[model samples]
Target: MLLGRLRDPYINYRHRRLFHVLRVSIALTVTFAVVHLFPLEHSSWALVSTVMVMGNLPHIGGVLDKGRQRLLGTLVGAGIGLLLISLPIPGRGVQIGALVAIAIATWLVFSSRQAYAGLMFAISLLLVIGNGAPDFSVALWRSADVLIGTLIGIAATLVILPHKATDVLRFMLADNLDRLARLYHAHTSATSAPGVDTRELLKATSALLVKQRGLVDAVHREGRLSRGEVDELISYQRRMLSTIELLLESHWTTREGHDRINAMQGLRDQQHSLARDLGTLAFQVRTGQPISTDISPFELHSFAELAVGARGTDGRMLFSPSGYLWLNRELARVAASTAQRLASLERLPSKRLRRRAGRHGLHEAQRLDSKEGSQNDPGSH
Candidate 1:
């Protein structure tokens, strides 16, 4: 039982962060050994460069981006240092004035996208200036050390036990969807289980979204999810959360509304439908399988007809018994879109494989198409 729970995506994903920590630890140890073997002067700079490149990023794509930036910055900085060494500066006063001007110019780094590169340029210049005699070889040597550290850090992450951001994203989404299912279950239980506050869970889900936002760029860099697909996923999640929140905050949460829903057979059926749909969605997301059947409505219009008489004298839903019905319609729309996106995503790999197969594999492609067709047939369900 314990093994099963550990294997579950919702629980297994939390350990991914620890793997990254281990990767950094290994990289740092190797870097120290390299520095000691080389017996390079001012070797602490090498350690700094390694950590700067690998400290936060775990995935290949993210590490690549950081490594590229770090290398670019180191090269640029070293070039500036070499230029300073070759220049005929008059005296210390002029050198201080130039350093002050460079310091002021550093603000551009903060405003620009390639801030790392700019910061490195400044650091390299400062290090060159600090070392007396303006020696060109020393400046170049320091830059080389920095480069060695950067390569080791990046290589350790890419080859040592690489982790993909795509897997992290899939696991995170599965966990969030499961939490959403539980939240919906609790809100629905408000009828019989009053005061089952879901505000915290709702808040928690939003916080999870904040973490997801950072992962999207890494995943996109990895070429797992495209820009359009990211937009669709974002849209579905936002709409889903908003509609669920509206339902929980509406009059249906009160005991009086619960009594009214219990009295109506149709509303009760719709409630069950919503619960079942959410459960199905959670399973589909966790397993990466798509249902072939058309997405079902969260609440039937026939149920809305049954709720027609449940309005205020002013004809406003204003926390009336029918308010939940409209929210259900909105939820149905979100569910359909979410399901459609998942279905299309699941088929993408097969589509790519067949296209790559060419005329030489035409027969095999045909077989695959037929197999896929059978899997996607609505009638099979």
Candidate 2:
């Protein structure tokens, strides 16, 4: 009963949120325990470091990446801090000049890609110089605390219901492919309204493209996916998006003669066949199953012949089919290529599959529940 209740979508979302809070809390607690046991000076810094490093769930990769950056920054800052403290210019004016110079340099660094390191450098400089005399030991201790806290954050992420980047990437890829299938169905369906808003599909694809970049970065940080695999996934997604855009353009350009295309038995049959094939491939991807369909080349030659021979009531070409055949052929080719890539991906061994299986099981249970609900409804019957 507890498991069933946890599987409820609202309950699951709350649990996920709570899980993240627990992970951070545990990390902070551990950091504090160590600091108190060792009687470390400036222990508050360690707590701050842990809080900064512990990100939300399903982003272990991001947490580790930030931790690495924090360590690197701390080291660079400590070095700079020590050097500034050791300067031999004994006058107050010289000290002020050094401070001004360090501030300007740190500001420049903060604007660069190594902004974290730059900020750390500035902070360390201030901490070291805040004392009446320059103390190199202070800089060292601060860096050590930051490193320790970072390690603690990383440990918390790995120990707590660890979320792997690979699984998240797989889920996102499957969801995006399914969205593409829906867009394709809408575009190709004979019954779809001519004035249907296609921009929504384009907007969704564009958002997915942006998300793909972030996921790729996360995977790279986690060091789970090889360079080749990353390249292939990114390339495949781009091609799919391009094909979707082409299909949308074709639909819009041919809107004036949409009735004629729908009326033609061959074109209608081919369109439906292509849409079904796409949907099947999408399902295979979402379920991590090997794709087995051999999509026959869209009968482009026949389509061209019919398009050229057809005439309207005014005895003119029914539509400007200039790139219509090419677009259809390209969509089929891209879909086939995407399916082949997904099939290859599915054959790879995944360590996160067991964890993902639980999520998939919940999805199945929810589906069953919805089916039962509908069956029990008098309106549905």
Candidate 3:
């Protein structure tokens, strides 16, 4: 079971690592080919530039972002270079001052979200100053060569065995949801404290937030996603997480904590219901389609209610009519929900459909009766 849980991370790391190795190797090969096939006036400079740009491939998105920044910086720096060189600077000191001013301007302008743009600006500034701003023709040619190298670098970074941010987002959704389910079960079972792992959960939740946010930003940068399905998937994840937070806060409240065990009697049933919905949702996300089947909405709503109702009550009163049965039902719902989602992701048959054979009915009935009014309501019945 533990090994299964680690599967996603293991696969993701392997794929990314492989991609890094392959992409870097290919980029280096391309650089060698470029140096041998098309010799430049400064072949060493060309090779150095190629390596600098291609070296960034392992950090795809970051390299692209930096390139954009560098472009912006370069444009501003070039303009500043033109003005500084055009000025009536009589001595070598004044010329040096002008170059410094242009470089600083480029740095400042390119510093925005795109670091690469700043780099471009600085490089352009230095090149132009060193060449004494030779006819615009010469400066433009050097800039063009640099741009070509930058393009090759960016292309290498984005293309080789590229992984999508959406994949990470989906993985996180499943991982965190599974953890939340386990935590909820533990809290209700008295196997764990109400406040335990709240910090960890919060941290995981924040990480999800960051990934989701980045995914959206990425899609926007693409101008549009393939369709609305991805957006809908993101929205569903947000809703699922909101519901999870609600359940956690309800469970933690002192007022609800004591009575919570009982009020959450229906939790199991609710979990079952939640599992179905979560499964359907995850399927839609994975396949990039809308949910074709309807999910039982009441299960999640009821579980949420039960969680809230169980708050801040006395532990002894946990077996009362309003406590035990309600909580048990809620727990069943939660368990079912968890199981369903997990099954969907793993492509496994759900536990709900598996029936145990040849159990003694009388013994089961007796056990159920004995536990009917008990606080520690296990869901075996």
Model 1, range 3-74, lDDT digits (tens) per residue? 444333333345657767888889999999998898787788889888988878877767776787778877
Error of 2 at 338 (Å): 2.4
What TM-scores do the predictions have? Answer: 0.74, 0.75, 0.57
lDDT tens string, model 2, 1-381? Answer: 555444332233335567678789888999999998997777788888888878553367767766777777676656666676777757564357547756786778665545666666566556656653666666667777877888899888877655555555665566666566566666666445344466876677678667667666556777757547866876777787787777777543345465545444566456556666665555444444456766666776656656677666667776555356567777778777776766666433342333354554745743563453344333334
Candidate with better TM-score, 1 vs 2: 2
- Best-to-worst ranking by TM-score: 2, 1, 3
Candidate 3 lDDT, tens digit per residue, 1-381?
433322232243336667666766776677667767874444454445556665533444445555565456556666666666666666675358655775675566563445456666667766656656445654555555565565666677676555444445545654555555434444445345345586587668657756666555344333323225345544544554555555555532244445444454565544443443444444333333333434443333444555444423344422232433344344444434543443344322222111211121323533452343133334544
Give the deviation of candidate 2 from the true structure as CA RMSD: 6.1
Per TM-score, the best of the predicted structures is 2
Candidate 3 local distance difference test against the native: 0.49
Each prediction's whole-model lDDT (CA): 0.65, 0.64, 0.49
RMSD of each: 8.7, 6.1, 10.8
Give the per-residue Cα lDDT of candidate 3 at 344. 44
TM-score of 3: 0.57
lDDT of 1 at 55: 76
